[model samples]
Target: MDIEAEKARKFRISDFDLIRLLGTGARSSIWEGRDTSTGKSFAIKRTFKQPEDDNRYLDQAINEYEIASRLQHPTIRKVFSLKRVRRVFSIREIHTVMELCLGKTLEEAPPNSLLEKCVVLIEVAKAVHEMNSKGYVHADMKPDNIVVSEKGRVKIIDLGLSCPLGTVKQRIQGTPSYMAPEQLVCWPLDARTDVYNFGATMYWALTGELPPTVVPHQDNSISAHQKSAIPPHIVKPGIPLHLSYLVTDCIKIEPSGRLGGMDAVATRILVIIRELERDQEPTFRIRQRHGTGHGGSFLVSEYRSVAVSERLGPERHVIR
Candidate 1:
């Protein structure tokens, strides 16, 4: 037997308990698993093919491992290990183990107040900024790809289709709803592509709607030129106008028109966060000390109706 075949034969299935199927992607099927040795939970990914099938997804699975190995960020999911050699009915397969973020995705989770959403959004923007800094674009970013931990930790997961910032793939690869105009045209991609996706993601989160984009797979009539996305401000008048503008800037049809890069987006959003924090610092602090909740439990003084306002944040949940 070859080295891989020998290794596969030696590895035992008892080492890990595959709990259940998590989800299926273009390259692999993800399973919720627990290591028998450490009793630790993980999301296990493997080629989604029967034993007799050829090695089509195996290479993509390996590529995902290579590309993901470089990432190390607080908000990005960690790939703990890779099992490149596995056996199922004498057929060699591949497996990748990733940290299992504890909480549900943004959509599945209970409704988060706008402030909570803003807090989540900034962290995701920071993660995207880091990826861009390292010369990679998280070519695939949607709400489902983002999971919040029980303790409120945000994690960006799934790197199956991520590519180098400027790479021109053989074909388009991205969720149709989130793809930027450049992706539709197969143009050289960069951080701005992620900006557009992030903007569209924000639009959906705020209005419970998917923003318009150039999706060639669906139809040619709604190309970026033929249609314009309805700005979030109009869709939901309650969202702060400034916040809506921030998202709109990211989804500009022209890359040059985007808000510079993800780093800049992060910085701009940080400013907004600081402003919100400052705005609430005065009377709200006294209320917390005097025993009052965030609702209408005002202190019955000059600032009686001083309730904490609902705020907005960011996140991406995959839809397909």
Candidate 2:
């Protein structure tokens, strides 16, 4: 009868009521749906095949469901199942049921404190590492895909671009500002690719500046080379040198030049957190010296800072 009712029926989710539209992308829309029997909420991502469309959107929805459903990490959004409505032999519509992240995306509502931002980044890094460990790469990692709950919990969403490790995509895939150089060159994508994306994200999150990538923002002409990202501490003075170097190292042009993997990224972020928690203004910078092993060694330089969270700003309660 109604549009929501029709969606529920068509998706074979008759026990759930489509409450409202949460977000939209491409030919897909995510709805906040509630289970009638249990009153539990979930995010329902539905995509339709339009007259002018091919099967790209449908394939992406299916890909998201298949990849995300296999991940059980708390920092990653959970996917339940895929539902398809077939018209004759052609599929007309598809739906993916996922965990409803009850807050705004990092792009929409970023945390105020640098420490809090690091916490969020650490969560995402760990989750990405988990995906890599499970033989997948989150080819797309950006602020818009990271949802932060009111209680400060973080959830990484949008697995549509994810692919098996060593996947060399047929076409360039990733947000321009955050796309790794390897992704631009159609090279074999491994955990290092995610490292670059994560680093670019961290760079922007901390300094509010986009890192240099092979693909410029929304430009058709691709750059043949990428310059080093300006260190975060240089862009923003108060940012700790430890973090600044880490961010710079992550966005290195060559995958071999960056950190070993996402696990290393999380470890370095944790070290920064621990140093900041100490609350002492220490004159030292921690630089990750590559080629040592999987875990890079840190070298010291002149730098000083207070606790990141308190120094940056007061932590305000996030209103969902």
Candidate 3:
């Protein structure tokens, strides 16, 4: 590292070097740092002092470490080490060290990058599937928790709300918009919950708009439960119908109705990639430009979607 970079790396707060502030939440702040002894870059998540809130945040940190430690997927951030420190002022602090993932969150992704978004989502889905197969649920799955690296790889982070399938019902956790309907009602959850959240995440990526908070009972208005049926072309015209349908199926309200699982989602995405590879020509029609008075025509190829699977399989159930 250069002298400036070295100086940047040396800045500290309460003995730990603050390489960079990764993100902040209601209870903690995450920072990028390096272990001086080993010279390895790691992500350090620090929780603030609030005795009453300490146990909650501490439990979350431990859960994150436990879940991540058991997972060895390319799309999941890896935890290297964890530690706790108590200051002379009587404040307890907890820190978790994870492999440094240099990238931006999907929330910060550019709107015009549809193909990029599709590719990233598929990778994340694969990772979530692997986690699910192991009986773990990433209770908090959202754009903010998905990291996009400079090399274009996606890694899911912040497993604070995650828990093994059977234990999640004891805690009502996860973000509002990304939370499944069952989660909102405090019902026991499973891998399908993550599938629903991932589907919503993809919807946000395709439309550049968040899923509607008010779920309409009828087809006249958009409902989160009906998200899997909304075509990308309906929001922004000209996207391939096949792609639009793919996204629609992923967001189905009934977990059983959604694409079979993450592996199924990945398989469908791969089919699209194969078709694109076979024919480099653009297959979908592009919308025409109205006039100078109106905005230029947006590229329809910029968005994608998924279709629902017709076949049925053994339902994966959680004991909770």
Candidate 4:
């Protein structure tokens, strides 16, 4: 270990109290921590240095910190600090402090309504599009890596597999159900790769089923670049045709055939979100106020149009 980076600090694990283990990776384990001074919750990822023959786990952790530090978006999880710790003379570990996105992973907490699906996908698309603009492809995009907070904030949580655009992944790094065809074959990655992943993620969010990965068809005429997609509308009969079309087009096996760019994909999804918002019928709220409408004093119940989709007290509800 350098003991000193060009700019950053070296600290010990004793600085924070570990609350619970969040998750584990090949070379790193994330723990929910509480800062000693601030007492605020944070997710700390402790990455153990791996030997050369073992995957570059330390480097990947640094890469995640670098990539996450550069991109700043509400839906994109943030890394607050990075520290290096030396447990022994020759052993070093990297600790990444991040915002504690409290909630169940999207894989664990499936969305219940179409509106919820639309809201989640729109935020994810915006964040991914931003990363694409900066030339990074989140090689892994899946429900397991997304946290839908108890307060309803959707955050993209992991970046271990993230790599720069135009970079060809040497190994398969993404989940099978959401992996783009090019990624599996080690093709150069770009914005379209994110589009495919986003499409697959949204497909699962809308329908309870996952998209079939691209595979070589039995006949020689069909190439491995062809994917067998079951439209969301097909699985979930209530899925709108427009959304069904959007999800199918997003997962096109070939890069050229899929939505050309994630920015465009995001825009198209935004349009759908707006349309969905408009389709929601306005709801009225009844407010009680003291007034004298007649000769006698009485309480007046006034009805005013409040809004739709937002929660209303304990009787929280969202339109499907």
Candidate 5:
């Protein structure tokens, strides 16, 4: 008898009461589970072996647990444990327990304003920086992987593609629209890779559009020839020019051209937010009686625009 198999046989799916199906992936499903012994709730991810996948899905499931469990950050969801089930001599299924994050993904409900989005991305940048400092790269980062709560808390989820810093993958892996150019080929991935993905994510969050990447989106016909992304302000008028420039810099094709690291990215965004808020205030509304009748006149004061282009200075890298 295999020692590991004997140990795993003691734990089974019946140990937890699966309350509801949270979500599903290619060959996996996430469930809201309650531990029968302790009555504690958790998010349980289960992946099953399949003939066509050839253990790819199982590898990812194990990778996700290994990488995520090592990371410790408030904005990053916590992964608790990994369980394997064997049928005789071979493992058949894997389950990972994680913090049951309650919120809608950024894809389902994005922040309503550029300010809100910037704030959310700032938290995300910090979380990724934490991952980098811990010697890991979050290879997959997109709107769908970030969950934002009603009270404005941000939590980064999904680490299946994550790897040790400077790891050269055996094959291309990442979401197409948000993938960095280096990710298209089997290149040595580092913090810069995450920078590109974060920038692409930010570009989409601010402009409601995807940035140009190596793997072109079905709707992005010009992506192949496009050298750089259009400034966010160009795609969306109200986005501050400074904010737009920062996002574009992040998605630069070459790793050296993008923001140096996640820390720099987070600090720069924080500065941008501070400048925007300090220089401008929310639009104010006023009402006055026009003809002294039931019908009254009301007018909303135009939103004041911040001169961020000038305030940001000639050198974009300077945070101050």
Candidate 6:
């Protein structure tokens, strides 16, 4: 949209046929571009003017290039090339060409679409696990940074904020709501920081509400030392008990108490999937639906039965 900034730029959209604007951010704009020679579609992230306030922007760009080029996973967006273009005004711009992702962010995804959300989360967890195993961490993990493809494939994007383990204490970066407490305090981070963020992301997926910015502590509370944290189930009753426990564990005030790493999180999710499958009966299947397009239609029936006591039999069945 800033025509003056782009005028006479070596990486003009005309060089490669422009499709449409994808999105714009503080320092860059993303566009869908087709390579003139190969006719291949790629997402081009172009930064016109570097932020004068933050010297880290250039470092982030270089880190992104380095990180993306080394990663090869189905759930991580692939980088095709990195180009440095200079304009007539003697200003240089950096363009990163990456795989074009087609779906909306998790923030924009509709509520009650539980299945799709779980699938996406699982894919992202796998990707994060891969990164953690390689001794890296996606310091900025949030809904908007994740891309869900048309076919429901999840890809983690925007590695500009990512860094190797124990290298993020220089600045407090990442979305505040989804940021771990250590990140907020500008402490040296590791895989545990990402685990905390992943928990926050899951909390959002399970409940439409976002978690509080800071946790509150109660003197007599069981987790009094943990601070302002509340269980996810307390906010959204529909969340399964196991899942609520898993999420809370990931967000524990002490990083050591959280899941060991992304691999542990992925394993737990896989275990949940298996348990759900094993519990399925020929008469009915219980699964959560995710995203929009259902039009409030109930894909399956809702049935609830009460038990008065451990010795009592299942009580009256209520169907909704």
Encode model 5's per-residue lDDT on 13-32: one tens digit a residue.
76798776666677777777
Model 2: CA > 4 A from native = 1-13, 215-225, 280-320
Candidate lDDT (C-alpha), each: 0.68, 0.76, 0.65, 0.72, 0.75, 0.69
Using TM-score as the measure, which candidate wins?
A: 2
| Alpha carbon deviation, residue 245, candidate 5 (Å) | 0.8
Q: Which ten residues in a row have the lowest lDDT in candidate 3?
A: 311-320
Predicted candidate 4 versus true structure: per-residue lDDT over 1-320, tens digit per residue: 33223113332366798776655666667777889998998888888864563536777888899999998877889998887666666446788999888666778766555655676776677778788888899878888888766555679998877889999877766788898878777778988988888888888888878898765334423264454687888898988899999988888877888888776776676667667656764442223222321223232232222232321111222211
Clashing pairs in 2: 284-303, 285-301
Residue range 1-320, candidate 1, lDDT tens digits: 23343334333344788776655555456667889989988887766455566665675666667777898887888887777564555436677888876556765552334545665677788888888889898877888788766544678876776788897766777788888887876778899989998888788887888877565545433244656777777998877777888988998887888997887777666666556656554333111112221222312221211222223223331111
Model 5 root mean square deviation, Cα atoms: 10.9
lDDT of 2 by residue, 136-244 (tens): 9998999989976644467898899999999988888778899887787677999999998898889888978898656543543335355666788988999988899
Off by over 4 Å in 6: 1-15, 50-54, 87-91, 215-226, 278-320
Clashes of 2: 2
What alpha-carbon RMSD in Å does predicted model 3 have with respect to the real structure? Answer: 9.9
Model 6 pairs whose backbones collide: 113-289, 113-290, 113-291, 114-289, 114-290, 215-228, 216-228
Over the full model, what C-alpha lDDT does candidate 6 score relative to the true structure?
0.69
TM-score of 6: 0.78
Error of 3 at 149 (Å): 1.5
- Which of candidates 2 and 4 reaches a greater lDDT? 2
What CA root-mean-square deviation does each model show from the true structure? 9.6, 10.9, 9.9, 11.3, 10.9, 9.4
Better of 1 and 6 by lDDT: 6
